[model samples]
Target: MLLFQLAFKYTKSQLQRPSYWLAVLSFALAISLMVVSLLVISAYEKTFEKSITQLLGQIQISYLSPNISLPKVLSYLQKEKIKVAKVTSFIHQEALLVKNGKVKGVLLEGLPAFEKKASSFFLKKTLNNTAITNFSKDRYGAYVPVLLMKDMSLQLGDAFSAVVAKSMGKNDFNRKVLKFYVKGVLDFGRSDYNRRYLLTSFEALQKPLKLSKKKTSGARLWLADKVFSEELSFKIQKHFSSKLIAQHWRQWANNLLEATKSQKKMIFLVLLIILIIAAFNIMSALFILIVQKTKELSILRVAGLSVTSIYAIFSLQAVFTGLLSLTLGFALGYLWAYLFLLIQSRYFSVLSQIYKLNHLKIGLPLWDMLIIIAVVLFLVLLTAIIPVYRAGKNSLPEGLSHEL
Candidate 1:
């Protein structure tokens, strides 16, 4: 009880000093800056991952044989339905879109109706709170990439036509032409996909291509769980006799994922450097405080306090400073994040010029918070150790007579 009272008294004395408050405030500012940076990066990564995964299923199944029929593949997938989340069959082909001899090459994707499976999948994966069954039910609805529309000077409800060709010789060539009214425009973040791709109903493409009812090009499979990609791919490949090629979505966006991972590591390293500097500041402050309090510590020793008790008193003061900084820092950080979000929301046009986002998103991961707290506590303890040891080892008269 006496030791506890001494520790409390020592910590209170430190807290009452302006220099101690300034040190605490500096540490808090440093911590808040680091935490806010981490939160911003983490939120960006989370949103980007969701956008990418929604645009491309976590896995895709393609034909090993170029001319493989879609019906057979659908049957195979149906037989292994337990492994897949959803299957979206699509035909992707290149076409020349000509209007008044202004020719442009486009990548056309023919899938289920814009209101059907594809739209549902997009809503489910991207929007999170929407239902797929509520999408528009227009039979001829088509989706065009924003870049494609911009290149063609097209608008929603504008009529556009394309000439589809097969790989056969000129005599055997069939010209498939159809006028389509633009239903929606997609703005996938990838420039290539945005510039080249168009989406339309599978029924619209099938009849124009004269494909049989049993034919389809390939299927995109959303795995029930991402971890099953390898095992399920192997099982499908073995069962399908090399007629099918299974690819995980990670493989498709490997470059993007790698870039994100590398950037995250760099950000962490940069923030860690900031935290290390803050730790050094804490060490310096504690050392100065020890020097200033040398006489008082000696007086405590003469009043029958043990060396271990003296060490405990200083250590407690250090811990109190650390905890106070952490509390104030976290509160200030959260307040800054909220204020940022509010300002961005109110003046998105102006903020977008700087942040490249419509709104500021700050997400604090629980594991990250725990790790940061642990590191800060460890650094605080380590920094205080030297000063505490010095106080414990110094002779009472020496400490009383000399500056620390």
Candidate 2:
């Protein structure tokens, strides 16, 4: 009790000094910066992962032949007791489009019409939400990429011609021309996808691709849990090894995912450097405070207080400062995050055109917060140890003779 009172009195006296406030401010700044940066990066990674996986599915199953029976695959999966969140079938092909005499090659994809209550997955990649809500309603309507729309000078409801090769040979090929109306503009946030992709109904492309209603190019599978993607993919591949191949989403976007991971590591490394500097500031401030209190500590020692008790008093002061800094830092960080979200909701445009998401989300990762707390506390404790040990070791005569 006596030691704590002495520690509190000493800490209170030091509040009038600039060095004390500098230490507190340094810690607070470091904590707040780390929290915000990590949250933003984590949100980016999650959005990117969802956009890619939702478009490609966690696992994709492709047939070895030109087309496979979609019904049979679904039935087989049901019989095999495989759990799936969602499944979508699509037909993909290459075609040439002409608008106003401008020629361009594009990858044409046909998706099945979803129920009125259920929305099509492709809508997530489109700029307009109502673009091709139900392909059954508008069979000839196509979702054109923004890049292609710009290149062809197309507007919504404009008509265009698509030529698909009925048969290909070395010297020549037979082609079939079809008319399609622009219903929506696609924006996947990547120039490569937005430059050459067109989406339409499965029924529209069946005759052109020479496939029946029962056939499809491939099926995409979304799992109930992402962690089981690789395992389920392997199982599905082994089960239908002769007829179909299964691939996980990680296989499709390995490079991009790896790049995000590297980016996160780089961000953490930079923030950690700042944190280390803050720790140094803390050490310097505490050392200075100890020097200024030399005469007071000597008085306590002369009054029969043990060196160990003196050490405990300084330790208490260090802990109090650290806890106070953490509280202020977290409060400031969360306040900033809330204000950012408010701003995002009211007055926001797409922040980055290179990423898949049009909006940003702020996420609080508990594990990350815990890690930061542990690291800061550890650094503070380590920093406090050195000066406290030096003070404990000071001879009574030296402290009594020394002047502040």
- Against the true structure, whose lDDT is highest? 2
Weakest 10 consecutive residues, lDDT, candidate 2? 114-123
Global Cα lDDT for candidate 2: 0.76
* Per-residue C-alpha lDDT of model 2 across residues 247-281, encoded as one tens digit per residue: 98778667867887798789888988898788887
- Candidate 2 — which residues are off by over 4 angstroms? 1-16, 27-40, 66-68, 71-80, 114-139, 168-173, 207-210, 292-313, 323-364, 394-404
Q: Which residue runs of candidate 1 sit more than 4 Å off their true CA positions?
A: 1-18, 25-37, 66-82, 97-103, 116-139, 167-172, 189-191, 234-241, 291-306, 309-313, 323-365, 397-404
Expressed as tens digits, the lDDT of each residue in 1-404 for candidate 1 is 77677667766777777877787887888778767766766765665555556655665677778556656656776687755667677777778876555779987778765555555433212212233233433334467766677788877666667878864675787677755666676765445666677777777677767676556667776667777765776676777777777776666656766876787778777877777677777777788777887888788789888888877877777777788888987888777777866875786655334323344446888877887687777778888898889878888788889754
Against the unseen true structure, what C-alpha lDDT does each candidate score? 0.69, 0.76
- Model 1, CA-based lDDT: 0.69
For model 2, state the Cα shift of residue 371 in Å: 2.4
Q: For model 1, name the residue pairs that clash.
A: 70-216
Error at 148, model 1, angstroms: 3.6
Backbone collisions counted per model: 1, 0
